[model samples]
Target: MFMVGRESEAFKHCTPIPILGVACYAFGLHLLKTCGIMRSIARADLDFSYITSRLAVMSQPAEGLVESAYRNHAEDVRALLEGRHKGHYTVYNLSGRRSGALSLHSGDATHMSGGNVVDCPGWKSHRAPPLSALYTLCEVMYDFLEADPKNICIAQCMDGKASSATLVCAFLMFVNMFPRPEDAAQMFAVKRTPPGLQPSEM
Candidate 1:
């Protein structure tokens, strides 16, 4: 799942930015950054070596778990984008490839170009902005999740549980059309704590 929106004349400012928690894989994070869906990323300073070690002990291979996690993460993202979200959070998926190499250009004359590379089939060009509709919802999600209104924090991820919680809070806000950010956070806190948690002990 990719985050996308209509082409804006001015890039959206990173005020209340979306926080992508570390629970997401590097590839997913990288895609958001490359697509310009993210304004700010939350990278908490903490020792995760122990958790990594523990993950290695699981019965299933670590690589498989990682891949499964990434797929689930993408599904969650798609749910947010396609679900009945209020405000500007609601977005439709766009598929198909562009005729030529996709490029991103800034008014300052800075530009970048890239496309799918194939070894035998030759290179392929995809349509520009494969994803759209994430710009506004991202802003609102940030506003709701931020702890301090002054120092706005957009997106965040912590442990698997907490990160899922954060995503659901934002999802609730967007889908239900909560009027106030506080309401969204509060509702999640009281009624939806650790929202959407999968049973791991089983």
Candidate 2:
């Protein structure tokens, strides 16, 4: 599911501006972050860390899921460039990579330069990443958000269920938005889908 979180506050500023959350599935899209003949507060997919093969895809209702992936990836940036989201947005990304992302950004600067995006190589699907690695990810996230409040960070994992969700929760706690990880987890559960965290995630 593609969950777009609004400008979350950090004290008085909108630091950690907007955290865009989505799952991994957009295999056909070759997304490149372009801004104003370009983009703004871009709402494209954050990351795709699948096994980089057909086995990564779901076995049932494959067409619908794939189509949704294609549509979301294609439409989001088009909407932004079309002036639908008029605000100037510097989007960052915080997620993991399995080997590396496939068609998602094989030719884009986001992949090549690692711009505002931070890849957590310790992470895989269904299970959460190492706690130490999570701390590092949160630090990078805080630095990114602190640099500019208007900057939005996008995050994702295989399905935004385990690693992705935990990262969000950890960021919330790390930034003191929530006093505890459990509090952040509760908030994530309320905002996103029901299965916000798997057992391992907790």
Q: What TM-score would every model get versus the actual structure?
A: 0.20, 0.50
Best prediction by TM-score: 2
Off by over 4 Å in 1: 1-158, 192-202
- Encode model 2's per-residue lDDT on 1-202: one tens digit a residue: 2222333232213122222322211111101112232221344352221211100111011124464654334234324323432232222222343213222323221232222223446566667767787777666554444444233444544454466567666666554444455656655554444445676676
Instruction: Summarize candidate 1's per-residue lDDT along 84-152 as a digit string, tens digits.
Output: 222222111111112111111111101111111111111111211111223343343333323221121
Clashing pairs in 2: 35-38, 35-39, 36-39, 41-89
- The weakest ten consecutive residues by lDDT in model 2 span 52-61
RMSD of each: 19.4, 12.4
For model 2, the stretches where C-alpha displacement exceeds 4 angstroms are 1-71, 74-116
lDDT of 2 at 164: 56
TM-score between candidate 1 and the true structure: 0.20
Each model's total of backbone clashes: 14, 4
